[model samples]
Target: MESIQPLIDKAHELIQRADQLQSKEPSVRSVPKLSKRIKAELNFLHTLQSGDVELKENQLQSTNLTHLEAVLSAAESLPGVSDIFSAKHATDEKGNQKTLVIDVIANHGAIWVKVTARRGHALYRVWQGEGDYGDKDIVEQALEYNNFASSNPVKFIVPKVHVMFLKGLPSEVKGELESVGIATHGHVLSNTDDHRIDVPCFDWSVLKELKVIHAGDPRRNRVNLDVSTMIAMTSNLTHNGCWFDYPECLLINDQAIEERHHPQLTALYDILKGKQLFACSTAITIYKDIVGNVAGPMEQARAKMLLTKVRIVDDCVSKRTQELGWSNKIKERPKIIFGTGDALEMVTVSANGSFIRSASKHNITYAVDLHQSRAFTERKEAQAVTIKKDDAFKRINLEQILRDLLNPS
Candidate 1:
């Protein structure tokens, strides 16, 4: 037993060093070495505990393996020591021998997170990286292999997959993602001092509760808008009494030119200036036409200023038609332009683009006439009474109008 004293002393020394290291500030550079040392020590203790007289060449020499293993295992059971686990991967079943590539997969209460990282500027898509695979491809494979969305744990609460970029995104790209309800972060792991393997699992239930709170607001999704509403707002701009009709609005550059300040139009501009709104490519083309021709240089500048903020949605014409149940009516009917109200519902314009109408069958849920909607009305009332000194229109009870618009009584 005297022969074991040196090995016992060394083991105690290692434990003391580890305890001291744990108390000091951690350095990312030193973490891997420390983990490896602790793992090796744990292995040595386990081997001695098994009473295997023939020690493997890789294991440290120890005579009191049983006692050492017991003590080391007990230490591991300490509250903070076992805070992390190595990320896991699963092999493909089709004999591909390729493991699903995921940086980390972990359960935090009811939410299971599958994290992927893109380290640079290359667009993330399938088979676009060095190995003919990219972050998206691996995530897609993981989803299929794990069947995550419909899996038992997810049935309780849907899983949120977060894609972390180790680099920053361009403003345009970030804005696009923001429109779709995805919030991205740059170097989330490194920024927070989270070692990939040591990230702590958290309770995701709070996120679910927050989502429930915002469930009633449609602004959570991107808002789509129609051309008629644009005309309604811009025609009121007092450029001329004849700013042209629907299709004419699209070709307004060829129309007569003018410069004037319409109060309602200015108020409408104030309402929409910073708001994130989507329009069909056609509607955008019309706005560009006006900018190029109808508007004076100053108005063109204003149009150019605002156009960048409006995202031109893809397949806008077809999507609008389909939503209106006119999939087959595409060529037969007048082109259905799209618009969104403050509530994020579809704004139905008359066939002739005369005005917004509530009785239109194409209405999604509630309808808004640009002339009479609560937001427009309240702004108009404010301008007329406060700015224009027009008492003919009393101030509408805007708070009630907003409540009615949101709750739809």
Candidate 2:
């Protein structure tokens, strides 16, 4: 190609000369010169060969790491794909340098594929150029990979093996691999669009055969507070006077539809429903003191309704012991029941009931005046307060405090 550069430049020069001559007025002298130059450039071009620009076997090409990573990321998301990792060999056994091997551990019956980035893409054209197809060598190497993987201490039953390719193979080649109880699949990573419908390239059939088991988040079933905590929170709300006194003044206005309590209520509901926290008599005392001034029948009825949702723990000593035992068995510690004033004493009796305490070994109790914290602020609504804690308490909002018995950090 380098040798042909001089000739190519000369041809371009001659074409420009011819173009200049043609652009001039149509004189006999100019027409003859243009024809002569055009003919010379044409003859030179004819002497050039296609082999000059063709890539030779010795030519080296670099893999695009960006494209490779994109392909790997997509592969990682494939159904049954897990534990995608890679290793780099500075020098191979033959003394070749810079070898990278990617291992894709997939499960159904537990299989693994070890491949180079270059050969990894079968269904999707991962790079800019042409794709690779199933080869006999690749098929053989895959067996060795599966064998190596199965030999590990981790137990897996890989009865069948499969070779992957970027492009589909001839029926004869597929039959050859199948003869050994091994399977082969051409590219299934690329998506297809037909009319208005779209189809993905993932092989669903393979996953079905594996019988992969899937599950949702485990903690979804766990609410923020337990039954006892809900009862304590309800008892607290009943005692909190302002919460009942300023229902419309605090959150609801002339333009409001429903009570603004749900935001706070729902936050508490989620925490209580999830059983994230434990509650005690201190929390109950705070609630009772907060709402103790309320004597209105409507207000009392509303308080009773909210209280109904709370599961009050039995006052019985055995039931309390049973509840405490249950809370201790879980992996996570129940949230603390926080309060101020007489809660300073870890143990104390109140006239209303036996001394209530957040005493479960698995749970905690924090006595703090959340209202005195910098995170607590007064809302625009004259009677209401806005409590917003940053970072540490970002998720623990005002309603959550009421429900979960957690003080602002």
Best by lDDT: 1
Q: lDDT tens string, model 1, 1-409?
A: 3444456566666566545544542321232444455556655655655677555544443333333332233223222222122232333456443333222222322222323333223333233443443235433443443443333222123344333333333343344444644444343233312332433332222332321222443443233445434443433233232232223233332221221122333344334433345666666676566545544443444455445455665433344334544333332223434333322343332223222222144433233224321111211222231122222222222122223222221
The per-model lDDT (C-alpha) reads 0.36, 0.35
Instruction: Evaluate residue 143 in candidate 1 and report its C-alpha lDDT on the 0 to 100 scale.
Output: 47
* Candidate 2, residue 115: lDDT: 33
Residue 222 displacement in candidate 1 (angstroms): 4.1
Segments of candidate 1 deviating more than 4 angstroms: 1-222, 228-262, 266-274, 317-320, 323-336, 339-369, 372-409
Error of 1 at 120 (Å): 65
Which structure among the candidates has the greatest TM-score? 1
Q: For residues 129-231, what per-residue lDDT tens digits would candidate 2 score against the true structure?
A: 3444532254445555544433331211232444544333334445655776556654433232221232334342443344222234322222222222333
